[model samples]
Structures are given as C-alpha cells and as structure tokens.
Target: MRNMILAVIGLLLLGCSGGQSSNSTMTVSGVAATGAAVSGTIFLKDSAGHELSMATTDGTFSFDVSALKPPFMLKASWGGKTMYSFAAAAGTANITPLTQMIVAAAASSTDLDAAYQAPSPTTFSTIAANLPAATANLRNSLKPLLASYGADMDPISGKFSANGSGMDGLLDHVAVTSVSGTVSITDRSSGATLFSATASPALANSVSAMNWANDSAAVAQDPDLKVSEAGDGLAVWWSYTGTGYGASVIQARWLNSEQSATQISTATGFAMMPKVAIDGNGNAVVVWMQSDNQLNNVWVNRYVAGSGWGSPKKLTSAVSSATGPSGVPSIAIDAAGNAVIMWNQSDAAVSSHFDVYTSQYSVANNAWSTPAMLSTGTNSAYGYKVVANNSGTAAVIYNQFQRTDGRGGNGDASDIWVATGTTAGGFATRTKVSSSANPIYGQGSLAIDPAGDILAAWIQNNNSGYFDVWASRQPAGGSWEAPKTVANSVTGECYSPEVALDAHGNAFATWEQQLDTEGRQYVAASHYSAASGVWDAPAEISENIGNTYDQHIAVDPSGNATLVWYQIESAAVTVRSAQYLQSSGWGISQLIATMGAAYDGYTVFPVPRVAVNSSGKSIIIWGTGSM
Candidate 1:
C-alpha cells in the first residue's frame, strides 16, 4: 500500500513540471524574401553553431525550437546567396537581405558566412551583446526611408508577408548587399548610395556615419556629377569645394577597380561641370570647364584601363577674334576610341552671342584637333549636346534664336536644330528640329541609340501663362517627326523637361509641373513606344508630398528608366528617385537622401543626375546643401 502511494506522488510531480517544459520550447516562423519570395532551406541555429531545426520553405518557414537560446540565428540558403536573421526571444524572424546585414554587423569575424556557419563561444557572446546596438544603428541609418512606414518596424521580430507591403515594400526599394566584409545599402530602384560600412565588430559604431546624409556634411556644393560605364567598370566625376581660386576642384572615383576618389585638376584654377565617357576597352575621357584668371576654357583628362589618369590637357585655345568664355561642354566616344567634344564659345565680336565649337580626339595619334565653329546662325547657339553611335556617326543638337527682323533681342524667337556627321569629319548637314514659334527658355535634351536614332525634348511656352513639354524623334536615315506636346497641363505649368532613349529607340520624358500657383510642384513622366509610335499618357511619378525641382532621367539598354529629383517637404528637402521597369510599370518613389529642417522662408535647391550602363545598372548623383 505504501509503494502505491509513492508512485502516485511521483506521477503528480511530473505533471506539475509539464507546463514549464512546454513554456521553454518556443516556435519561430517567418517569411524569407529578396523583393520576391525566397524558396530555399531554412535552418535554426544556436550561438554554438548547432542546428536545432531545419525546414524546407517556399518563403514561409516554421521551426519548433526546443532548447531555447537568447540570441537565436536563422539562415535561409538560396541558390545564389544566403540570407540571415536574428531573434532575441524567438517568435518571428524573417530572413532577408536586411537581416543579413544586421547579422554581419553583429558577428566578430570578417567573413560573414563562415562565421555564421561555425561561431566560436567568444564570437557568439559578442554577437549576442552587439545585436541590439547594431539593430539600432540600422534603424537610424534608414530613418528617412522608414518615415512612411513605422519608424520602429523591426525587420527581424516583426511579422510580415512577402507580398511587398509595409516592411516588405521598404525592402523592395532598398538593396542590402555584402562583399567580403563590406556591406553596402543603396536605393534598389535608382542605385543611389545610401550607406556603406565594413562588416566588422565595430560596424555598430561606424554605421553612425550615415547620419551625414541628414545632418549636413562638409561636402561642397554643386556636385555636378557625371558617370560612365566601361564593361563592368564605372567612372564617376564631380566638382567639390576645394581651397583654390574658384573654391572648387574636379574629382574622379573609379568603381569595380582600385576604388578611390582622386583629384584630377590642378590647384591653379577651379574646375566645374565635368562630363565622363568610357569606351569598350575600359578607357575613359573626362571633360570639364575650368576657369583661370584670364578666361574660362575646356579641359580634358584621359584614363587608361590598367594605367591611371594622365596629364590634363587644355582643349580650347582662344582665337584672336573670340576671347570670351567657352563652357557647357559635351563629350561622346565611338567604338574605335575616337571622341568628339562640343562646347559653346562666346563670340567676342558680339557680346552675349555664343557659337558652338567642336574638337575631335584621335586615339591612334593621342591628339586633339583644333577647335572649330559648328553653329551656323549669328544668334546665340547655347545648350548644345553631342552623342555618338557605335558606327562612329555623331549628332549635335542645340537651341538657336531666329528673328524675322534679323536682330537679337526680346523679340527673337528660338527653335531647336540638329547637325549630323562623324568625329573624323565636322558635324555638317544642319537641319531644323522644332517648328514652334514660341521662345525656348532653356537648352533641349538629346538622346541617341546605337542605330543613330535620335530623340529630343524641350520646354516651350504654350502661348498661355504656362509652358509645355515637347518632344521630337528622328528615325535612322529619316526626317525629323513633327514636334508633339508630350506633357501639357491645362491647369498647371510645366518646365525643366529631360528625355532618355533606350537601345531600341523607345523614349522616356520627365518634368516638373505645378498644379497652381499656390500648389506644390509635382514630377510627371511620359513614355513613347518605338513599335506603336504613340506617346503614353503622362503619369504623376511623385507622391505630391512637396514641391519638386531639378529633375533628371536616364534609361538603360533594357528599357528600364530611372528618374531623380529634389523634393521640398515641409522644412526639409529630400532627394528622391523612381524606377520604371520594362516588365513592371513603375515602382514607388524612393528617398535617396534627406536634409535637416531649415529656417522658415528659406528654400533649398538640389540638382540630381543619373546614368545607366548596358546591363541595366544605374548610378544616381546629386548636389546637397543646407536645407
């Protein structure tokens, strides 16, 4: 009888402890995505590198962890790359590029994947203690992008779907990529660099440098940035405030090679507005306007593939007759390494009258031809651009004034004109491109494809109180099509139109339109199909959050277009960019950078530019100042 009583006592004791064991076991589940869903194998690991559970997931994963760990790690191994996540007390942990970045930051070892595969005890403890701080840094770094979503949206612990909404939507616009020990965060839609840091144990501290985007940095104004791609390499040029005569100097950064920003201009003068073009053999030529004590002239610098930048050469020597400034230079290189550079030189005989001049560079001889006038009329031929096709055929476009009275003044009317030829020969065979009687306010944009097809866009006064965006096309060996109003706002005014042409002659145009004098300016866009030969209806690409200005656009060979602009929101200003995929219509506008709030009544203006390579990779750059 006594033995039976003891057995009953033992059974009751076991029942009392059952609830405790069940409470210790935690079930963790989440979705893995890389913009879209990630189909792979998910593994739940402890700090000691032991896999507690494994599950095959088609984006959604579940794992019942028995031995609960404080710093639990989740990894999803896909085909190309693997993503990782972290959980303090397991409930939900989504494996994604963002989480992978956090994991890399928290890990002690430089090799992220290797460290996660088999973490030592000391490294594991380091990760456990550093995870919280690393996560806080990430949140602060992406504060501008997370403003629309909840600022406290936890990428690791928050529950989310892979359907591209809320947190998932934010992920779609950002690109978190890791190479070796370096992690880079960029706007996925525009390829604008947001933040980058080394994935070391000190990443938690270094990530704070990204605050420079919000809080102003010592970086100079008017980054007049330009970029070009040669094969898999990229060359970027910009002018920044340096201690010199004009307080600015030109700098170049080489990407996918020895990554560094080198000053390409001498300290004797100030260099500004540098344009770069790279050939197929990875060589590049950068052209810019330099101002000396005497006059403003055009300068050129050559960069060899394996070699570095060569000596700077002055391309423009003032003629005895025309001694004024020579500026607004444009450059293009053909397949054979020959280059054409065009600029506007002020005619000394007539004040304020500028003429277009051209200079050709022969690669075999490594010499530049003497500058020669290319414009025909006596009026100012400003805002000229030159583009080259693969076959060495080059085209130049500019805005020239025409007055019925044969005089230059407020009564003069302007029209767009084009000239076609080669770098070997001068740009001859000039033709009129626009038939508008209205005056042109600014220079028109020009774009050309590999087949010598051309597209141009400009803002023309609609004879009303506002301006309209007009575009024209020239088929290969065909005449210029009639100018059409691509974007006309009956209620608002439009200005600053920019156009881009893809490899197949499809075109994209973007501009800023103000709904009313009291309303904020909005960014608008239109698309033209080469096959249908029809311009699509204008679409508002901006979110109408603030007044927009300094808009720019570029299109890749795959027909993907990226548009960038400055948006003034409340007291702060933001640099925003949007992507138009050939497959999908348009992605949401992404905030690339932002500035702190400024004093009331003070306005800030930032100019944005974009360039794309043949493989759909794009680089966006902009100028930032006090907001």
Candidate 2:
C-alpha cells in the first residue's frame, strides 16, 4: 500500500510539471512615444474574431494561453481609433513589435491596396458638387480680392505694407458683401440639434471678434479661481487663482449650487495649494503656502460656524530665498478642527538635504505646535500628499529619492513612503510602502480608507524600460501588499497619478497617458479590488476630448467616480468633466469653461483640480483668464 501511494504522488507531481510546461505564456510590452497612454480598450482576438483578453494599464501586459494557436492577433483601441495590433504564435514570448502595431492603429484605409493612398481634391469633389449655387457665387466674389493679394485671401485682416505700417489703409478699400448663413450645433449623443441660427457676415465677424478677445483675456490670467461648490452645505473649500497665488473661503451646500466666497486673506506675495476640511459643527480649517519677500512660508486660517474668519497665522518661519521650501503643500483637518499641514522643505545649509515637515494647529489653544521632521534619510524628499480621517488620524505619502544614485541618474530613483499619526499633528516615523528594489520616480497621490488603510498610486519606471501606473495598498496594521501595475499601455509615458477611495474602500485612480500616433494626451482610469488583490484593467475616460493633462479624480458616496482635467480646444485650455456611471461606463464629457487665450506666444496650460463629496456631487476649480 505504501509503494502504491508513493507511485500515485510521483505521478501527480509529474502531471503538474507537465501541465505548466505545456501552457503557452506571452508577455506584451511597449512604450508610449508621447507623455502618457491614451484612453482606450485593448483586446486579444483569435482568427475567428473571438476575444481572448484585454489590457487596461499602459506599459506592458502578459497573457498565459493554455490552448495553442498560430498567428494570433491582439488589437488595442482608444477613442474611435485602433492604436495597435500585432500577431503572435502559440509559444511566443516578449512580443515587442510595436511599429507594425502602431501603423495598423493609425487613421488610414484598412484596404491593403489603399493603405498608402492619400486622398486628393477629387476625393472631396462629390461633397462640393452638392453645394448650393449661391455658395459658389460667394466664392467667385472673393477670387479677384484673393488674386490681388497674390493668391492668399486677406479678408478680415488686410495685407500689411512692406514698411510695416498699419493695414487699416488697405482695409478701407476692401468691401465685404453681406451673405446670410445658417449655423447649427447638434448633440452628438442625443442626435438633437441644440442650436441653429442664421446670420450675416457682419454679425459673424462681430461675434467672432468678441469671442477671440474673451478667450484671449481668459488665457492671460494664467490661474483663476473657479467655484466648485457653494452655499452653506457639506464640505466646502476655496481654490486659488493667478498662478496659484491666493484663495478665498467659499461656502457651498451642494455641487451645483452657487458659492458664497469670502476672501480669507491674501499676502503681498503669492499663495498656493489651499486645503480645507470641515468639522461637525460646520467650522473649517484651511492651510496653504504663502510667499512674501522672496520667502515661501506656510499659513493657516480658521472659520467658525457662527463667527467670521480668523486671523491668518504663519506656520513656517523658513525664508524663501535662493534656497528655500518649495513644491506643493497639503493640509488636512480633524473632527476638532485642528489642522495638520505637510510640505517639502529644502535645507540648503546641509549636503543632499531635503525633508518632509509637519505641524499641528490647535483650535482650542489657537496656536501651532513646533514643526517636526517626518523623514530622516540621505535622499531628497518631495511630493508630499496627505489625507486625514475624521478620527484624528492623518496619513502622509511622499516620494524619497537618493541623490547621485546610478539608477535613473540623479533624481531618477525614488519610492513612495507612508507615515501615519494618531493626532492630526506630527508623525513619529515614516515607513517605505513601495518595494525598495524597484523604486518609483514620479510624484504620487494617496487615499485613506475609512478603516485607516492607506492606498497610494504613482507612475513607476518599470523593468520593461517604460513608465506605468502602479498602486500599493497597506492595511491598517499590516505591511503593504506587493505593488501591482494597474494600467498596461506601451505607447507612451504615464504620470501624475491621483487616487480616491470610497467609503467601502473601492479605489479609483486617474492619470494622463500618451497616444501612439498623434502624441496627444489622454485620461485613463482603473479600480483596485481589495478582495481579489488585482487591479481592474484601465479604461479610457475621455475619448472625443484630446490633449488632456493634470487629471484629478474623486469618488462619491455612491461609489461613482468623477474625473476632471484640462483639455486644449480651439487653441484654448478648457476644463472638462466626466462622471463614471454605475452600469453605463463613463458619461459624455461636458466642458466646464475655457481658461483664456494664448499667452506670450504659447497657450496657457490649465492645471485644474477637482474634489467630490459623499452626496454624489463634485466641485471642479481651475485657473483661467478673467472675463
């Protein structure tokens, strides 16, 4: 009987090894040529059009195929475009043929014979043939004027003189005949024409000029404060404008309500990164960085429920000089309305020195405690992101880099570190949550669960020689689980990760990814599951919108997540928002407002920030040119 049992165990072990050897595993890897991965879906399909798998993250992907098939093709899609496609055999490994996949993913004719063909004027002649005769007559009227200007039409702005004199003299001689035309704007999703009007050339020109001037002014302001929510309700905070200079305290009841803003305080210098948290009695604690006399310092202010705003108190005594504290700062408030602020301070006096500092403000005593150092190491510490639970506990996450490290040259090798504290004050020590061997480079964001578990997300330079969005979760008292790549895309760089945790601990992360073809920036998002210990494949949130950057995501109490970002449209940066529908995926994007026109020969980049409350409403604030 013992001999029989041993024979059975040996056969079972041999069977397991044979099964593993027979399985075919293929790993897909590629890098985005642009800044990040574009939003879209990728699927592995067989010859019969059967879907085998899908990819969400941007960087690299792996698949284990038990069944063998020759010439299996994988397709990657984003927006209305298929960004990549490649063929694989039954036993292939390390598939990195990105060129062919990129070519197939471009906007071109699928027909093999027509692949290289470019459409000529003849291709559009059919549409021209259907044009009204009056339209042709209008074109004929401009021909003589265009010919007089050497084949280029100088209609609105007359040709300038060679001596660089004003063109108003030439403009007087040109006569623009009034031609009535109809304009129509249709809702693409609803198949309804929302607006239609008829106007003459003079009216059109007047409206165009007005719009141009408005957009121009809007862009010139650089950073402008926008109200996210308002009117005596739940969780209200104010956003700063003017290159993140100063902010006011805005009170709001819900997301869509108009905000009643009260100027909290403004220094002669700039202020930025203002954070606000509300206590049970409707009191608010606000903290931000202030700059004056070339020195950037931290400040805090409080607003009582019945009383008015309190006097601004300076938290940091660091002088802003050639070497001073810099980068973005974060703040959180506890139930007692005490404020906890964290910021990165550089000590130029010490070699290889940068540290994360924290301080506490007591509402009862109306005083701030002495600042405490949270990180102790040789590397430069930066990118301090903090979150506070009402239970007087706050968690801070930041990137720590070792100077002169060979890994990514200087400032290349970094990792995410987390520090937890019982009070909304100083941290005892910070522990490294990310793996030490595989360090992350870019800045990361953090979200804390109701139970005090910490979830952090950041962009990491992976072993595949590309950057991808990675996430790490640490239970309340346990060590951090292994880091996992959330979104898999190989077309571009992924950076600026922001995460939001719902009440149930569901995590949603959003970041900017690059497209393979146009090199346009796109927004991608994914969710982390605690039970499965796996990140759901990332999905593109914005499809029609392109050139998106600085995406911020927030989750409502209903477990729905809303994503907001700045997108370039018609040469202006516009703030756009998209909400995640429970069963319908992402809703159609809506444009919030346009920032303004080009500034100093370049369009201003809109770095909008967003926050949402438990009531399924959100407030989005951004800087823009004044009207």
TM-score of each: 0.68, 0.58
Q: Report the error of model 1 at residue 20, Å.
A: 42
Top lDDT: which candidate number?
Answer: 1
Estimate candidate 2's alpha-carbon lDDT, on a 0 to 1 scale: 0.52
Candidate 1 weakest ten by summed lDDT: 1-10
Q: Could you tell me the TM-score of candidate 2?
A: 0.58
Model 2 Cα lDDT, one tens digit per residue, 189-264: 3222221212222111110000111232232223222112221223233343534433323222222222234555
RMSD of 1: 13.8
The Cα local distance difference test for each model comes to: 0.69, 0.52
Model number with the top TM-score: 1
Instruction: Give the per-residue lDDT of model 1 (tens digit) for 1-627.
Output: 011111000111111334433244456677777666666678777776668645453577776654645567777887867777876555667777777777777774446667667756666677768888878766644554565444346777666544455676776776777654546677665465565545664442121112223322224244443334432334344445645467676777653233346778776677777887777676788898888665789999988878879988887864444458887689988867789999988766675687788899888888998888887746677778898875788888888877533235454678888888887776878888787677666558888888889888887777675778888898998998999989766778788787888888898988888888567788999999999998999999999788788888877776877788888787567777777766557766777776545412234455566666665545555554435
lDDT measured at residue 70 in model 1 versus the true structure, 0 to 100:
50
